[model samples]
Target: MRYEKGRKDASRSRIMEVATQRFRGDGIAASGLASIMSDAGLTNGAFYPHFPSKAALVRECVAAALEGQSGQIAQALASGGLATAVDAYLSAQHRDNPGTGCASAALLPEIAREQPETRQLYTERLMTLVRQVSAALPPHTSDPEAVAFGIFATLIGALQLARAVEGADLSDRILAAGADAARSMAQPRGGAGQEPAETGVTIAAKTERER
Candidate 1:
């Protein structure tokens, strides 16, 4: 009984891990349960014993992915400032490795269409990231929270545009530009009480208001 239980637990873990990759890379609806089970070298029957349904498994996988990303961001922050962390993040390697990279960049669009539980989980994960960035931001800013939002918007918009572009050169350029802009915005203004520039104007907001 003990041996069988251990095997079952291992299989369940494998399922969750595989599902996380597929759901992050693809969408939740595209990653069928049978395929996930087969990829884990298990039969379909074994899956039900672990999760009540596909949705349940997806929820678990999404939660796991969120937690994994949170841990990565935390580790990056522990090492250095926002620019340092972002320089590592918005790179060719990270862009190439979407399967195991930031969950926000990988799964933002899908999260909008996911169930309430998944959306809630995604929200919590994002808040954690915003908090991490906000903490790393320099003290001279008038509103650090607002600065955090600007930084995130810039990062996501650049990455999305980069991902949409076909050429490798353009993609890398977009990522680099995004990282540079984020770094520039993160710097505190000169001595004592100089107010930072109005850098929080989001690209989206500017385009809409301009139009």
Candidate 2:
């Protein structure tokens, strides 16, 4: 018997949602299709109707995740500028909740090893994210796109490190350090021979050095 289109679509959405969390919480390779299907309340056979293969599901999920993150970052930037966005990304809640946190922090290594098509999709989505940040930067900032990339990389790397290590104190420090690094990168991208503006972290460091 043929299922209704709406039902099929709903089933596909459920599968993607469950798989996205599973893949992020557990590494992609570790999250088996059987487990994902089961978690989605579907039998193994129900999988093929929505997606031809596991890789296809992964590609779609990653793309969706990046799109969601871009929207969130845009909102944060709008409300409190890049600083708020950076803090939200590197917060302890984000670090502890890999299942619901940044896809890059959860799966960058796997992403690097994905097939060419998956990488291409990720690259395009990444550029969209970069553009979102670039648009938020100051008009006087030099190479805003490049600065956005630096800021994103800093946030992603710091979040991953924070999640990997043991201990609450160390993890919190990692988040703080990551926020500082990301903010430092977000500082004014000065023109030639001009000083970049000082961030809070930099000002504190300079004061410590003077003392």
Candidate 3:
């Protein structure tokens, strides 16, 4: 029954990796540990050593996905700016592959129904994400955090709606509309966050502490 530290760590990681995709592809309530363990190539008994319960696993998986997403958003914004990030997020590929895409888009409803601890973790992580986007907003922007929140809501809602509806045409239209709406949400009142549409929304200066 004894496993080395490294082996236990690897097994734990594998479990989370498989569970993340499973939870996103099939709702959390629908994904069983038996199946998740099977997918992770571990026996049912191995799971208990890594996590006390399915709720614990769910918390870990949610945190992992969001942490990865933070890097993705940073990369997208750095390479091409906000529009590119929005396009990538609202793309057909992302919509079709919920198993490996945004956690919020795939699991928002389930997260809302999770225990208070999990919900609190989500809120804290979400604020970090919002801040990342907010820091990139143009100078003199009015309430950039609120703007980022709106943009994230538009993107997450649009993706969820797109995946729910039947037909490529409607889904594509939804995605397109979502992108436009997210960009518009970023544009603050009184021309504070204004940027040339074609030029893309570049990052504003961040202080050394922020960096």
Candidate 4:
């Protein structure tokens, strides 16, 4: 019984993992259950036992994707501060890779059209991210929550715009510009005359292109 349960749990996890990649790479509407199941090395019939319906799977996948992104943001902020997190978020690598990138940027449009429950779940996850960003702001920032919201909005808009454009140079420029803007916003208001913070994210992004 223990082995069977363990095997079932593993299969369910694998299903969610593959579904996350597919839903992000191809829009949720474009990715069908049979294809997802086949990609997970399971037959179509195997999907029913794991997820009651396609929508159920989508809800689970959406939650998992957002949780994963939040975890990355928290780690980035912990290791390198807000500047590092912002820089990495608005970097070219993240822009080019939607499958493993921010869920909001990759699926906001489709999410808007989802059922109310799905939207509610997304909203909860989004607020979690906002709170994380808010807490990571500099100590002197007057209104951390509002500032965090603004920063988060900027990041999402910049990524969406960058991906919408056709040229590689233009995309890189957008990401760089966004990163600079985010870093500047993170600065304390009274420190306008102080030296800029040291953030190697932009430099790293440029180097990635050169390599």
Among these predicted structures, which one has the highest TM-score? 2
| TM-score for all models, in order of appearance | 0.83, 0.94, 0.89, 0.87
How many clashing pairs per prediction, in order? 0, 0, 0, 0
Between prediction 1 and prediction 3, the one with superior lDDT is 3
Clashing pairs in 2: none
Off by over 4 Å in 1: 1-3, 190-211
- Judged by lDDT against the true structure, how good is candidate 4? 0.87
Give residue 179's error in model 1 in angstroms: 0.6
lDDT of 1 at 60: 80
Compute the lDDT of residue 82 as modeled in candidate 2. Answer: 86
For candidate 4, lDDT tens digit of each residue in 85-201? Answer: 988999888888898888888899999999999999999999999899989888878889899888988999999999999999999888888888788778766566765454457
Per-residue lDDT tens digits of candidate 1, residues 26-136? 767788988888888888888888899887887787677767766776787788757667777787877877777666777777778878987887677778778878888
Instruction: Return the candidate ranking by TM-score, descending.
Output: 2, 3, 4, 1
Candidate 1 clashing pairs? none
Q: Which window of ten consecutive residues has the lowest lDDT sum in model 2? A: 183-192
RMSD of each: 6.0, 1.7, 8.2, 6.0
lDDT of each: 0.78, 0.91, 0.89, 0.87
Stretches > 4 Å off in candidate 4: 1-3, 191-211
